[model samples]
Target: MRCVANTGRMSRGECSSIRAASDVGTAVELGAVVSQWVGRVVPHEGYMLAAVDPVTGVGCFLAREHGYSQAAARRLIVGDRSDGDHPYPFDRRARQSRVGVFNTDAPGLRRNEAMRDVMLDQGVGSELRIALAHAGTMWGGLVLLRPRGARPFSADESVQAQRLARDIVAAMRRYAAAAPPEPSGLALPPGVLVIGTGGGAIAAERVVAATPSAREWLDELGTRPADALTTSDPPVESIVWILTQTVRTTDKPAMTRVPTKRGWIVLNAQPLTGGTDVAVTVQPAVGTDLLPAMAFWHGLTPKERAVVEQVLEGLAAKQIARRLEMSPHTLNDHFKSIYRKLGVSAREELIARLLR
Candidate 1:
């Protein structure tokens, strides 16, 4: 895709911050950089950089604001069920066969089908979107939203945002290739792997233990665990092969973001310059841990996790009850819910399962 150069907004370091960031760091850096440009000196609602998987229409939220949860954001922005038709920005310029900025308030979007699906229906009164396109396909984009009745993105602001989007696209590709988010290699196994041509198992890395089938997911795209992923399964890889493929058609470093129940998972890949291997780093797009991920898969709510933390702390039932300000019966109910959700019958088993 074409990423035009611009000036006077993002600092050089901020533009290059993704180079040093982890997968999540890429998202954070994108958010911070764009905010610096848009916010000027003040913070706004927030922004998002999502990597789209064209085939499935599901990518992960690389970076977002505190007000927007990754899961919900994924559902709204890149989810197939949400806006499978009538994409923004790209569609606005589709007739001209170009990729550019799309503003919800512009005449270009007056009757746009995707606008309702993307912004109007989602409580976003106004938005500015820029698409990263290559080979007539959209790989990823930046979406800035405003609350209903808030001022819509001005024409000047939209132009600036679009220009910034283009400039960052090329820089992002370079940073991803030069220094991917992977650890030294899969020998260290950091929930990511690299595959060879023809989709064969070139390397298998250690994913989170409970997420046993992450290896197979790495084996081939669109494949899931052999067993049905119950509530306990980590959200399937929100793998993004779109932009990586777009930017590195023949040779380049590329990355993508996949959504999970707890957060986004970034899949960064680069062809090893000297070897046939393409290093792919699989990691969270945000700071997260096993407990929260596991809890999410098992359908454990925050309150349940709270109870679990107290239990893990060796708090007696009486103490736990007092702390939560609930009666003993209510505490027992939570215990029962936790046990059922976690598939355990006793406290010892619960602790063992959790620890394991």
Candidate 2:
């Protein structure tokens, strides 16, 4: 029950958090902080702070202005970006330190009809966006939208937003790091699922590969594809909670995160294609440094990964060769290549790098 007092001149859109659990308390707090910060800075309709992972091409909004609808907010959080060329102002143009402003009536935008259409379709009169970037990576950005009939943002307001962009990026960065690495050994289909209005499974499908993190999430829900529409579980209850809150009109509850001993499992539910059932996506919050991520980065082949995994187990060359069904000489070749590509000197360094 943290209180978000007014921070600046604009003193509107302040609301109390109804989420009781602390599983996502830090992120919720970050949202409250950013939302309040935006409110204080300008007298706009709403603002959203988004965290984007350029490596994964996944983006999330930690805080969204209160006036947005749950359906719209959910789409923004977990929907497809290929809908059209929208007003994603914080793009490569702002990859450095530039702040972006998108206004429907701006004369400069008369030539870019696509941009104008996006703004009109969104029913927004103006917007402010800033991309959070570091070391050539675009982590994410912030966007403030003013609805139709509202006045366009003044230059000072844009400057004020620019000043806060870096701090907001840092805030999202800390929020992402707070989730411990995914620490479970359960398996399930990819990150997608379909839930009924009552929070029971309707039909589930895979959008990502199954991993221990996904399995543990299903275990938490006490659910599976077979249980679709059959019964409700604790996890289903939580999903139902979010659904109910979303329907409350005032609460902009778009997503929920479950805290675990090792890390965080996030659940994103949206209305399915037919609008009768909700689709839920499950994912781990922190696991970017794991084997697959490292292997891809280090350009390791399947054989290299197998050999490295064996080496990390303290197996000697003879045993590793026998187990891999390769001769001792052949095993030595892989070790040499692995060492060279990974910039490691010996098996010890290889294991150290992998474990890290």
Highest lDDT among the candidates is held by which one? 2
Sequence-dependent TM-score of model 2: 0.48
Worst 10 residues of 2 by lDDT: 14-23
Error of 1 at 233 (Å): 6.2
Which lDDT tens digits does candidate 2 get at residues 132-220? 66545566676667776777766777777666555565555545544433322334444555444343222122222233344446545
List the candidate 2 regions with Cα displacement exceeding 4 Å.
Answer: 1-28, 60-62, 67-94, 106-123, 184-356
What is the C-alpha local distance difference test score of each model? 0.48, 0.51
Residue-level lDDT of model 1, residues 35-82, one tens digit each, is 544454222455666544432223433455633443344434334323
Model 2 sits at a Cα RMSD from the real structure of 12.0
For each of the candidates, the C-alpha root-mean-square deviation to the true structure, in angstroms, is 19.1, 12.0
- Clashes in predicted model 1: 3
